[model samples]
Target: MIHKREFLRRNLPYDGRIKLASYYNSRHVRVPVKAAQITKAVRWHASLLQPVTGIDPAQLSARSLRAGGAMALLAGQCDTNTIKLLCRWHSDAMMRYLHQQSLPIFQRLSSKMFNNGSYTFLPEDWVPAAAE
Candidate 1:
């Protein structure tokens, strides 16, 4: 999930020698990247995160970084509208990532709705279930 600026940076080391098309393939060759190779690259990146997160690499893809980054920005208190644009979402599609927040909101609302904080609607109504 290289952003536009980061994609440019990947070419910085090579300078003038390798132009726009250079990154299309691995270091040993100069052929255009194929789907299989790209998938391997994503898998490799996902694999590196497994040791730190205890998450299965098989469950992650390069898109995981984008989704994680969006959630991170939200957790950091960045504006939802800003995150939406940074993620290149033309619509409110980025709001989908904030789906985790929905649980907390629902719990809070349900708690108040069901007799002023005595929430029988959900067992763990006070605590956010998404964090678990």
Candidate 2:
């Protein structure tokens, strides 16, 4: 994935100005993308995810990327404040990401549950203490 990201960055045509996204249309015109363009790009790229993840491409939208990113941060055990800042979410809205956790979170909890010894104790009858 790191290599693919690097390759994409290297292969992409970069103008003198550094933009978040730059792409060439079939007409060979460079489109310097803005926020709205990124949404379109994300939706188009989501189609590519179907083949890689076997998910219904139609069901995935640009917003999925934000959710997935947030979930990734949650799985990483990043601080709640950091996640909120990174995600630009206000209030405790980011906590919703914890509601439907990813597999990594479940696996981590499961590992801890198994690795940590369980506590078991039987209570004995209480007896009066004698004066020392």
Candidate 3:
């Protein structure tokens, strides 16, 4: 969801070819990066290395952040459907990870549901308040 202005700002000018030809003739143009590099670049930009915070970039890794995100999602009551969509996981690996992480919450929810007399709740009585 990058804005067009941001894209233009970050990218080489559309007229770069004319400028490059005048400046550096006979030089090979760099090949376009693969999708993996693009993903990595975006991830790195969004990582824990903030200039204001002065956090050491060496202390952060994509894998650690990914694991932390998964754990946070589990704690935040995000469902498997949401996780699958967010993480782009097509296999059962995410399910296994979520199951492992969410075992305690699942157990508690199951116990609560079972202990209740019925799973269904009674409809709330609705009354329209007088207009102010």
Candidate 4:
């Protein structure tokens, strides 16, 4: 990805302006892209990935990227406030996106549950001395 960006930077005539998404027009000149175009491109790529991923192309769109990022942050144990800010979510709606936890994470958590060791308080026969 870095190499592709470098190639674009070197080949395009952006006049020192940096833009991640752009394309050459019919006149062979580079033009800035619109949000819709970017969304379409993302969905197109998702469609190409369907065969290998077994995910329906219609189930994914550019919005999936944002949702995926939120899920990743949740899995990383990021605070809700930070995730909300990063995802630009104004409300607690981001909570809904956190419903799923990866199986590996659950397995690790379950393993740690009993491996942390066990302890008990003083027995019934034990008594504390009075503080004179």
lDDT value for model 3: 0.59
- Model 1 steric clash pairs: none
The lDDT leader among the candidates is 4
Task: Please write out the lDDT profile of model 1 over residues 25-80, one tens digit for every residue.
Answer: 33434464455565677778768887887777677665666677888887776887
lDDT per residue (tens digit) for residues 1-132 in model 3 = 223333365574454343211221234333444445545764576464567666554444545455567768878888767777787777657765566667788888987877765655458866678999
7-91: candidate 4 lDDT, tens digit per residue: 5756854444556467665555557777666678877887888889888767766677777899898789787799999989999
lDDT of each: 0.64, 0.68, 0.59, 0.72
Listed per model in order, the count of residue pairs whose N, CA or C atoms clash below 3 Å is 0, 0, 0, 0
| 102 Cα displacement, candidate 1 (Å) | 7.6
Candidate 1, superposed: residue stretches over 4 Å from native: 1-39, 48-52, 101-132
**What TM-score would every model get versus the actual structure?**
0.47, 0.52, 0.42, 0.54
Best by TM-score: 4
Q: How far in Å is the alpha carbon of 27 misplaced in model 3? A: 19
Model 1 TM-score on a 0 to 1 scale = 0.47
lDDT of 2 by residue, 12-116 (tens): 643445443666666555566565655677667767786887766556555667778888888778877898898889888766656676666777788787666
Cα deviation at 50, candidate 4, in Å, is: 1.4
**Which portions of model 4 show Cα errors greater than 4 Å?**
1-35, 101-107, 110-132
Find the 10 residues in a row with the least total lDDT in model 2.
1-10
How many Å off is the CA of 1 in candidate 4? 18
How big is the positional error of residue 97 in model 4, measured in Å on the Cα after superposition?
Answer: 1.9
| Candidate 1 RMSD to the correct structure | 11.6
